[model samples]
Target chain A: MIGTLILVVCCLLSTERLIIHAPRPGRLRTPDLITLRSDQRFAQLKAVLPTTGVLGYVEAPGTVNAAHYYLAQYALAPLVVDYSPQHALVVGNFFADSPPDLSPNLLLIKDFGDGVLLLANKDVR
Target chain B: MAVALAAFLCFASGFALVSLFSSGTVPDASAVLFNLTLSAGFGLGIFSLAFFLARIFAISNIIAVDAAVLVCLIAALLLARNASASTNLLMFSPGADEQWPRWLRRILVAATSLALCGALYAAIMQALAHPQGGGWDAFAIWNLHARFLFLAGSHWRDGFSSLIPWSHPDYPLLVPAAIANFWTFIGHDDPHVPAAVGLLLTFAAVGLLFSSLSMLRGRVAAMLASLTLLATPFFIEQGTWQYADIPLAFFFLATIALLAVSDEQSLARGSSSSGFLALAGITAGFAGWTKNEGVLFVCGIILARQIVFLRAGRKRSEINPSFHRHSSAFLLGCAPVILLIIYCKHRLAPPGDLFTSPASMLHRLLEPFRFEIVVKAFLRRFFSFGGWLGIPGTVLLLAFYFIVGRGQRRGLPAGHRASILALFLTFIGYFCVYLITPYDLFWHLRFSLDRLFLQLWPSTVFLFFLLITPQKLPLSSNVSR
Candidate 1:
């Protein structure tokens, strides 16, 4: 009886270990505006992003006016804009129209999509 | 109505028989009735004892305490009458004249008293710590209904309105309504009061069951069973939580005891045993009213009893007549509770969605299978040791298996065999019900399966101890073996 109990305890402890060591499924990666569409470019850009901060994305059909207003309202993260000829100069406009209350950490990077661009925290790689 | 009348008559008759046969001293019919009433009063006294203590400690409201006390008193009285009938029937067995040793009797009584104390202490301590809702069912269903009743007030009927979509409108309201009536008298609609009262009733049922089973069996069985139940992690935890599982378990055990008595009487000739059969039916009916799974238990017991009767009647001529008569009496006694449940479900509350919409019910039933949910649930419920029985029960079960053989051994009498069979059937019934449950079986099993087993813990332990305990030792033996 003592031997059997010991065996049972050993088996249970092993099962507990297996449960703890099981691999978890990966989460979906949030899109970054400044990263290029190529897998390698996106990977490189992802590495430079803040490890702890959230990645915000905006997708709307209308003009950039509404998107700009939403970005201003929720200004915690920099806007990610799709790489496009029209959005190339929008980085300058973002820097010019930046709210005085905006943290100095907000840094406008390059665009990734048609009109999408990436913003980064100044401390990020 | 017929069922209620039959149950009342059976109880009345059992009281008379107990009065007649008690210690070979027959009291008058009036005196018997008075004693029966007194026993009921005693039951109420026990309830009041617990309630008053709860109130004194500010653990429960006076109104909730009073209602719980009253219900418990009534249930205890009914159960005690049943127990007396059971004891008398056991005494009529051929070898019953071989009186129990005086020391053994004293040990039995002391052990039973201690078990009752332990169950009471555990329940009270749990309730004091978590007064409002200790069990999950109490929060998810029973107390939720109480909350609705209190909040809805004049529109309390609205509480059962199917418009809510989430609440089970068709569920019976006997328990919640009783609490609502207390709230009405106090002119204060406090949901906590009803929830607390429900917890008190749950504990009272556990106490009475443990005490009664102990008295019927022996002290050792009683102690083991009570300890198994009180120490069961889930049951003890829920004893503090407000849930209907404990109450349902109480009613389930009451029905099992009733059936056991009836079965015993079936074997004995010239014995007046119709009362217990009816009482068992009534208890089963109440069980059905308590919860949906209770209806399954009622079905299981009825089917098992019918099967037993048929088999017995085929072999013996004398068994035929009593089987028919007793079966009818059982059905007659069960009629009121059944009707009450039907009325509450169909007329008072909304129609059952599970059956009415076949498509929906089928969808729900098949969903568990699709996700490997039932397998997961079964494994979890079967292997988990955190229930009312806790570590002690696991140890006892392990010891029981090692000490007692696993397969068929033929030393036990027919009566003992039948009792064990009935217990096994009841356990299987609970298991099968969970396997097919439409709700989240995992959550349901986690919260309830253990406590449900605790309902039969006492009876199982009693049977176990009786079987495993050494009958006699050689006079010349040096060691205690």
Candidate 2:
């Protein structure tokens, strides 16, 4: 009897949580913009990048966490996006419109716009 | 349409495989539900294996391969169907004793159906809200791997390069390969594919729990057990997150259920068919293919079976060679997937993150602080893991279990004993993994501890129901072994 009561209580609690956590109808209508922007931001870069191989990645400094790095990696899969600028070819991602502060050994190869820059490691070759 | 077709193919393939192996003494309706639930996971696993091997062999046209495999499975299924009529396998009688009153059972059934509707609503809403799937892991890990497998073409091997360690290139490819296989059929990566897969697995897990319980326990017990799972809000949320944990949990639950049924059949007829054990092995192997933790599960279950096998042998004062045969059948089922995992580890994927130098690992293991922290975290998480609204679910279940007594009259059946022991061992393995974790102990636990628990949650619930009931519910009415 107590077991059944507990099951009843659990069911009620779950229903409550379900209602609380359910997304609003309006919210589902919009495209997931952050995901879209992330995918689109790297679209051109992906086209130019080699089909396979490791490439160095640099993002805006404070945003050096796994989230942004993994997002970029997600956008450019099959191409290993190493979270470092030591490779011969580096992909520079900056949030601001201006040029990112690059290390002296890194040379700008091309700016594909949208804060996505290609850099060549002068120290490599 | 492509997603639907792929899903149908997977379900069909799994149904055929399940029908080929499983026959029962349970009623036809219950058997269909049980077999269908198992088919969902099995089909997905089959696709994962087939797609992975095709990629390994550079067979880019996965559609043809899938279709071919489907044809072969159906043919074999037909043969098995004909052969089943002539076979004599042990079947257990369903326990009709102590059934709940009709009115109460109807109330419970009505309550369960309502809860199911609510869960379905929440899951669909969750999927709609995040059409791209949930959280960072959805995009970063599982989906990213799928994109690699689907888009990288012949160069898919590049995704496993050591250069990108954060994406967990070492992780198994069940989710990714299955998603990629569907994408290949669709001619593009539809984000809905993963979402659909996630939703399919989540409900399949629920369905498997309900159907298995219905067979093993009475309808009332089945409804109550399933209600507990459905009430766990976080489980529904996590399932929509498009992660591999739910799939892992499904396989875990499936393995235990199969073993329990197989053991019951053996006890009834004084013998066993290799079919059920073989199917259990396949599920265990797929568990390994689903996640790294699943590999640990495979080990834990094997150790569990060995312990049980030896005990039963000793009790009989002679080792039953049928135990050896069962074990071999299990191994035979596991062999194909295990070999694939070994190949992936040795030849394709980067080294996993958990292990480090033996000296460093040992030193970490010796740290008293780490042990204290992990224990406290586990204890806290144990009570709160499901993100219940009030009076956390686990605590309530425990309270109920104790108040009603442990149902210790028969002690645990041998299969349940092995399964419970396996889960306990798996928990120990998780604790040990935390002790020697290479990452920040806090971060690792924060990110993964709840998920790890969730992986075992469904099985734990099923086992709990089985224990509390303590009756030998009929597994099947006319079920084949």
Candidate 3:
């Protein structure tokens, strides 16, 4: 009787947890919006982005989504992600509500909304 | 269409290699499932090997890889076509030995089915929640490395540059290589691929536990064991999290399953063939190839087995159960992957972050504080690691064995006991790593301890079920392909 109860309780609780998080089966065909949005957000900027060299990535130091740096790097691979905002072309992921203060020499080339900004460093070597 | 053909070729190559190495020729559900799982792993091995060679030769196209894989597949299939019939055939008959009441059996089955349904839902939900995976390590490390491999073409080496030390490029490439192989076939990276792979490994681990145990133990034991694994919330989540932990768990379970079968065969036959032991060794070697921790498991398992034999005080003898023969056969199986791992560590990859600076490591090891933290963490996670929902699964499982007490034999064979001791040894090995780690000790433990426990959890369940199982085997059951 105790064995049955243990199994029953475990089965029910695990199932409940899964059901709460389970997405509609239909939505599976739709790839994650993270990738989709990243692609859409970077679609036009890809042309101006360097075809063969390292791309720079800069973000506010303590934002929750430091992951956007890696995702942007992933979506636009073949280009190295240099986290230091030292390169001529740097991806400024201002994931917070407002953009971060930066060197005046750096100019905003594109704003892919929702705080995804592309900044070009004017002080290029 | 081309991708379909490539996948088929990959499966064929793996299937052929497994069929060749397999001890049991009879095609039972468990045997077929185990063989298919092995094939998938071996197929990935073939792809990684060819891709690694392709890089050295400055060749990085789909056509070159497809041709090589096809040739290898066909050759392996043809050469091993006439391999002899299995000396032992394993069949699944739920109540072959003793009879449980019909209502009891039905209840057990219903409970197992519900647990399985729960597991499936969790895995699906996880995949849907983050098609790219939810954890920091997924996108940041594994998938990121795969992007480097697939998108960077010949310049894949750029990913291992010393600049991005956080990526841990020195880590073995099994998970990344498998994902990259699938992407190369499809012609572009897909976020769904990792999700799918994660789910596959997750379910595959359960399948492996069920099938192997059912054949070796019985249906009741198998169901309860698999249910324990399936009901673990973290196991399901980590499976879809696109981390190496689940994959490493699969390989660990495979090693234990193979070794258990080999031990069973040796007990049954006066002299067992080395086929199963060889396969166990190979699986152990694959474990080493999967993660750095796997290398420790391989060594720990072997060391534990030797220690058991040494303590037994057996005289040296030329016989079927001779410790020397079995150990040597196991080593023979591990040789190929061991070589590949050595080459990868010495030649292709960057220095591993852990244990890189000996002076600092020595300093850290000498510090008495590190040992206290790790021990406390180990004990904390030990009770909590099952990832159960309401109550911890481990607590319930312990209640299970205690209530089910002595209804059947629960003691283990010498070999199975060695496997259990090896697991404990591996835990000790993990402790040693925690002691010497270069990273901030708490941070490393916070992120990784649960997973390290998870890697051994399934195998622990397998062992627990093995002991509690009724050990009477019925001879000459009808076989099904």
Give a tens-digit lDDT track for model 3, residues B1-481. Answer: 8567666766776666666566346756767777777677666656656666666577867556757776865676556554554444444344542555567667778877987887787677668867878776887688888888877777887777655537777877777877787788888887877887788778888888987887887766777788788878888888888898888898888888888887776665545567667777877887887789999999988898888767653532322456678888889988888888898788778888887999988888889999999999998887787656667777776777787745755445667878999999998988988999988899999989999999999999998888877664634443323
* TM-score, predicted candidate 1 vs. hidden true structure: 0.57
lDDT tens per residue, model 2, B1-481: 8767887888888987886776433345666688889999999999988898899999978988888888998899787766666332333345542555667677787888888988999899888888887788888789989999998989898878777767788999999999999898889887888998889889998898887777666666678788889988889999899889998999999998888767766765566677878899999999999999999999999999899878867666233458888889888888889889999999998778888578899999999999999999999998887988877778878877877645444556566788999999999999999999989999999999999989999999898887787566334434443
Best by DockQ: 2
What are the runs in model 3 whose C-alpha is more than 4 Å off?
Answer: A1-9, A21-32, A49-53, A60-65, A86-89, A95-101, A104-125, B63-67, B81-97, B313-319, B405-411, B474-481
Candidate 1 vs candidate 3: which has greater lDDT? 3
What is the fnat value (0 to 1) for candidate 2?
A: 0.62
Give the range of the ten consecutive residues with the poorest summed lDDT in model 3 chain B: B312-321
Model 2 scores what on Cα lDDT? 0.83
What TM-scores do the predictions have?
0.57, 0.94, 0.89
Compared with the true structure, all predictions reach lDDT values of: 0.46, 0.83, 0.75
Q: All candidates: CA RMSD in angstroms?
A: 17.8, 2.4, 3.5
Say which prediction, candidate 2 or candidate 3, comes out ahead on DockQ: 2
Which scores greater on TM-score, model 1 or model 2? 2
Residues B1-481, model 1: lDDT tens digits: 4323322332343343333332222223322332353233122223323332442254434445544545554566666556553333333212221334556545445544554454455455544444444433444356546544543433345556554344466775545544443454445544345445545545545454444443344334444455444444455455455555655666666566555444544444334456666666766676676677677666666666666656655656435365678778678767876776666676567776445655655565565563366556545655665432223455546555575434324364333454566667777766655555566667767666666765565456445644543222111211111
